[model samples]
Target chain A: MAAEVEVVKNKQVLLKDYVTGFPKESDVIISTENTISLKVPENSSGVLVKNLYLSCDPFMRGLMRKPAPNSRTPLPAYKPASPIYGFVVAKVVDSSHPKFKKDDLVWGLAGWEEYSLITETDLLFKIEHTDVPLSYYTGILGLAGITAYGGFYEVCNPKKGEKVFVSAASGAVGQLVGQFAKLTGCYVVGSAGSKEKVDLLKNKFGFDGAFNYKEEHDLDAALKRHFPQGIDIYFENVGGKMLDAVLLNMNMFGRIAVCGMISQYNLDEPEGVKNLMWLIHKRINMRGYSAAEYYPHYTKFLDLVLPHIREKKITYVEDIAEGLESVPAALAGLFSGRNVGKQVIVVARE
Target chain B: MAAEVEVVKNKQVLLKDYVTGFPKESDVIISTENTISLKVPENSSGVLVKNLYLSCDPFMRGLMRKPAPNSRTPLPAYKPASPIYGFVVAKVVDSSHPKFKKDDLVWGLAGWEEYSLITETDLLFKIEHTDVPLSYYTGILGLAGITAYGGFYEVCNPKKGEKVFVSAASGAVGQLVGQFAKLTGCYVVGSAGSKEKVDLLKNKFGFDGAFNYKEEHDLDAALKRHFPQGIDIYFENVGGKMLDAVLLNMNMFGRIAVCGMISQYNLDEPEGVKNLMWLIHKRINMRGYSAAEYYPHYTKFLDLVLPHIREKKITYVEDIAEGLESVPAALAGLFSGRNVGKQVIVVARE
Candidate 1:
């Protein structure tokens, strides 16, 4: 005995084609030809959501490239002229799943559109805390937070007084990791592409030291100057030459938690890691991890971080591009280092 | 009172010069000019030992090269006309240390000479349980064994039914790793340079499968064929191209225990690992370890491996060259894949 649901226009940012190199705003088209019902279909098990915020991450660039022949990750290719998918914060408008209900706010993977039919409800986590800004779920309170937590604590096993280094320091995960390192009483240094981000890392994020990598001609000398002894933990966000330099400066028994290799994503071929021999020479441990595998620890992470957020012990910086039409430009800006902190698109605010 | 021990001529293998590129037999010179006293110097905490077996490992090649300006490990440059140093099995002729006594059979770092005055007796481990072949101290029951045990069990954290892959399968560490993988109830594949080694890996070492990497035109294709479901554990003994290929074939959450990079040891410029990006894509854990770090686990490793050795569940192969005169050729042969198994120089027979 339910009333027939209203149908509405669904505006989406669609990929014009699979990108070759660095992506441009012109490569995506904002389309409003599609429509979606406001209610779940008869006998359907999916939840219908109104997308609010979408994340613009550097990893998204890798998705735009044609997958390698032997690529193990079988992430679905973006169909020409179809809406692409990424991490999204949404409101459940209609639901047939037992775990989710109407009007519940949740965060997980969804399409780059105003409305989405999420067939896979398992990945979606219902947002319980409403005191914080809802858009925080797009970055600091969601995947990026989990990534920083797991990569720094679990993978690196960081210790107090350890020398920690982070690349792409003002990005979503990097900014959080620097703060976490400080909380653990570790001496941390961060490298960013610009002076403003470097200043933000030192002044706002509370990192012990910060540097503009673009200004340093010799990364090895720069690292040597910053870490005279050597780096104990390296949160590797940018790969290629940065990784090569980090390898040379790593201390014995050092740990490198590989989160995302943003520098290598847009390249036709990844830059070779030349000094990997140091891995053997110094007895270093380098591990690569994805936030998806850490979903089980999400509640634990929330408990640890939420109190810090509420007490003002921790802070998150966001760079938001308003509306669905700005999605392409926001995503493209990630590669150019335009966004200062977490790049988010405010698709449709509740 | 002990009589003043007489000095005797010590036949030695001397380095002609700090080597560049692949080493040659002429790179080392046989010198009989050196002499050693049979007694430890009065009040000196040292052990005087007669060398019996000298181990020629791939790491020695790195020692021949001039150290890089920023090299972390400052191994002393091999002085011309002076005997080089490596792992050696020797009988203590005289001892001033409480832990070591006269006539104790021990193995540790020593000069490539007939007799050595070991100032640092701490590294020497007294050979207990002499029921096994004394020469076994050079390879199977020594550093090679410890490397395999710690790298596979501690570093790799191998699980039953996992798919394991090993490079340089016929060499000292790789041979042991393959056997240990089998003991763990894992599916194991190995790559060697020659067909004889390949056959030995399958028939003698009981590997599930093995291939001659030299014969295989495409290493990735070969790995794909052997590890159709992808590799869960990679015992990385040979780095460079093999490492690159293994990265492509690694399964999600795969562990790579890097024991050595024998292939890149002689190169002026080490080959770049191009597919390291797959490390992030697959959530792989690659760790580099050395036997030196696992000294604390020596007893535990012996407890696990000794039973297998006594029960004939495990076996070792040694390609031995007789006398100090043959040491140079034996060491040089390692680069050309001339040695079938563990390359040992039989300085003297007990």
Candidate 2:
């Protein structure tokens, strides 16, 4: 096995080139010739990690676009000829940093390769609780988890008995938000892209109601039917026309937490929401936030959510593909809604 | 003098046959005979008051629209044949209710006529802190003042050294927000419709910078020039294209308090904001609120602002029309940006 590993070297999938429109599998390529040493560099201030699981998220589509004139987070965050990177659960194979030791399980930004060398020490967090599956760190325990927690609690400021609606209910962050809202004593409903996801939301996540957005001819009517009292808090994972429809149906003083606009990200023109005037009329509070800002609550979150996972009070699902070669398809699957729950690529076995 | 008094019975105006587009002076007609005695019915639990002053706001333009399916406010709030009622400073001539009494000055919703009978006791607040001019209650001492205070301080959560850009600088609410932002140690800038208002913002209201929005060909560039560091708090009094421009110039985690959308109120088709996607990129917070909702804060606001008004620390501007006959033109002026500061109709002198 070591001989075969030595012959093949470390494989990586490059950006190939910056993307346009909907990103195709051809936009990124798997190249096997990239090399990495098993040992950490002498006098280095970096951690050498063996990437085990890589996360696929909708935000990567924005990264694929070359920095436009008005772009804030630039293309340099994902340069061409460099390996693609995202949230990944990894093992510290060797560490030159004093804080981490060999075999320490960590999760953060890592490359789409068998191995990665990271210089940004602050971004890396050492994993502590492992009662849940380690692959969950790539999702429910990592960025996606924090996103659901912060966007729902912090941004929406949910009150008990408030009606909450989540778009993309079967997706990684949306599923967790529905559960969190339920725990908060709020009535929660969710909209998904498929029948399977709709069922999962109601049966597995215990969402108050679930609807397939594709099957619903009128989103406004669908929301009204599901939420007769009107929605107080909207966890906005899907934007575009759904946002417009939701705006029309929102109750007075509604709070909209826009974690991401997945529905609009890959579109050619990105749909325009005509009903924004409703925001003014209804006195809605709409805010967009990133999860990275809520790191202070991570410990408290672990304390609350870990127990739920242990007692089977909460559940998480993942669509995982094996090998670094499957990374491209795993990410592409996110856009098409082909993968239910969180999609993760397993680069190596323990 | 008794015959003149009988001939000069206080009048009210009706919008002429539901006009569309920008309001004109010809849209309203006045009749002195329309008003009844300034008294609540016998044994009734309503408070009847003499409307000493009537408020003319940009929002009234929306009320003038023929009732639509999606109307936010109640229909009787703006009856066509009856006198239009809004925020007014009045003197309780007689009361059948426990909360108010004869000669008590109050700030509340009132008809455009010389008197109004209000059964809704919750809406009226007995005017306190009379050390300031009673007319001040019609402007900086009343609804506009509290709207600015709550929206800027509570909704925006403004920080010291934050950059605050207020649209419609010299208008009723905008003028107060600039002062409040300054009081909070924020650097304030404002956009007005005319050069005089621009000068008034900087010289009178103490805004750090002010611009005539009408003169600026490109509003985004105007915002950039004034707020070189990007705006942290945007007091949005004018929506449509101005809002789109402001979105592009917002800093990360910026807050926009939507007080009113004066620009789009009269249009058949409200303009769409194209750059809304920036809300996600910039992590902006946009919230809309009305002064009525912040009734709990009225005493707190009065206690803070009254002293400032009495001491001349906070100066208010009023465009007063001497008689009810001038009320139509005064109200119409709000939409065209003709009224600088608060537009008020003074029906009588003390």
Who wins the DockQ comparison? 1
- What is the C-alpha local distance difference test score of each model? 0.90, 0.83
**Model 2 lDDT per residue over A252-317, tens place:** 999999888887778767665666767777899999788877877999878878999999888998
Candidate 1 lDDT by residue in tens digits, A217-333: 999999999999999999999999999999999999999999988888778888888888889888999999888878899999999999999998888999998999898788888
DockQ of each: 0.72, 0.51
Clashes of each: 0, 0
Find the 10 residues in a row with the least total lDDT in model 1 chain A.
A66-75
Give the distance in Å from residue A11's predicted Cα in candidate 2 to where it truly belongs: 0.9
lDDT of 1 by residue, B1-350 (tens): 87867999999988999998889999999998888889988978899999999998888888888777766583566778788998899999999889999999999989999999999765789999799988888898888988898899999999999999999998988899999999999999999999899999999999999999998889999999999999999999889889999998899999999888888888888788888878888999999988888888888888988999999999788898898899888989999889999999998986
**Which candidate comes out best when scored by TM-score?**
1
Each prediction's RMSD over C-alphas, in Å, is 1.5, 3.5
* Cα lDDT of model 2 by residue, B1-350, tens digit: 32222222566776666668988887777766664655566677888788787778777787777776654563243555656778788888878888889999898877777777788877788986677777777778777888888888899999999999999889899899999889899999999989889989989999999998888899989998998899999999888889989998999999999888888778787776666777878889999888767779888888888788767778888888888888777877888888888898887755
For model 1, the interface Cα RMSD in angstroms equals 1.4
Candidate 2 residues lying further than 4 Å off, grouped into runs, are A1-8, A69-71, A74-76, A268-270, B1-10, B16-20, B32-35, B70-77, B128-131
